[model samples]
Target: MIQNSKLFIAAAATLVAAVVLNPTPEQHRARIKEAIAERSPLAGFLGVGALTAFASTYHPLGLASYTTVNDHTVSIGVLGMVFVLQPSKDT
Candidate 1:
């Protein structure tokens, strides 16, 4: 679990660095699309992770915390879906 967290941090850092380097507009769009695709699974994993972490911290109410995390995750996922489907400026 610790290892997974480290990996997620590394991946996010790399992504931030790549974006900060500032590719061309087309490259940026492509990168965004690729990133959204690649990180989709991570997003779900993060939701689960958050739930687990919450469980560890709060103890007794873990199930309810997990459900809340899941709900938030779904909302975020839906928002991302909307973002991905929106027409690009280049289009």
Candidate 2:
């Protein structure tokens, strides 16, 4: 039981670190591509099949945020606190 708790803690910590890193848009795109190439479930978890110019809103209690906009935009909610990935100016 103690070992299991330790393993769970380690997994949670790793996830928190990954989320906090907040991959760049390019990196996010690459991640999606790689996931697809490897046929990983993470592909769908990343987001839409492909990212294109689009508008999205993040509700106060939203779990995740995603958008492809021209100007820089940012939104954070309750669970969003876990994964804070703000949209930057699309170049």
Candidate 3:
């Protein structure tokens, strides 16, 4: 438990530092997709919902997220915390 806490702290700190220095979502193509997706209100709405589900770690919304470290994958958000997302399967 203590080791998991430490890893979570370290990962959170690193994620925050990286974002502060480069405050953008993890992917370049995401920006493009966001631009395209937001053009329609439905897409924007679902995008917001998906983001909320991702943040809240709610499965009913069908939004799943994970990250990989040293070839090991770990959950992020209402599950476990470590690593940033690799890439979205869609877009």
Candidate 4:
């Protein structure tokens, strides 16, 4: 429990850093794809195309995004905190 929470917090911090540094979805995807490539070549190759497909709306200090490759997940970030969710396939 505590260990899992720590890992989750670390992941969230890393994700926030990535988002902050890579403000655009394309840049963020590329960074993630590179990381994936480092671990698995095949998935990285496949990621090239899927990761390219994303729609985003950004505000002066925040962003809202929809990514197909992430199981149709929608993500929103404000004040450095990010939230993500996958809607039902039926929708």
lDDT of candidate 1 at residue 36, scale 0 to 100: 45
Tens-digit lDDT string for candidate 4 (1-91) = 9999999999998768655653455544444445545556886677742353333333333333433443443444344434443336687
TM-score of 3: 0.25
The number of the candidate with the highest TM-score is 4
Ranking by lDDT: 4, 2, 3, 1
Candidate 4: Cα lDDT at 19: 56
Q: Candidate 3: minimum summed lDDT over ten consecutive residues — where?
A: 55-64
**Alpha-carbon RMSD of each model:** 18.0, 11.7, 12.3, 10.0
**Position 78, candidate 1: lDDT:** 18
Per-residue lDDT of 29 in model 4: 46
Query: Using Cα atoms with residue i matched to residue i, what is each candidate's TM-score against the true structure?
Result: 0.26, 0.29, 0.25, 0.31
lDDT of 3 at 84: 34
The global C-alpha lDDT for each of the candidates, from Candidate 1 onward, is 0.36, 0.42, 0.40, 0.49
- The sequence of per-residue lDDT tens digits that candidate 1 reaches over residues 11-33 is 98766654454333233233334
Best by lDDT: 4
Q: State how far residue 13 of model 2 sits from its true place (Å).
A: 0.3
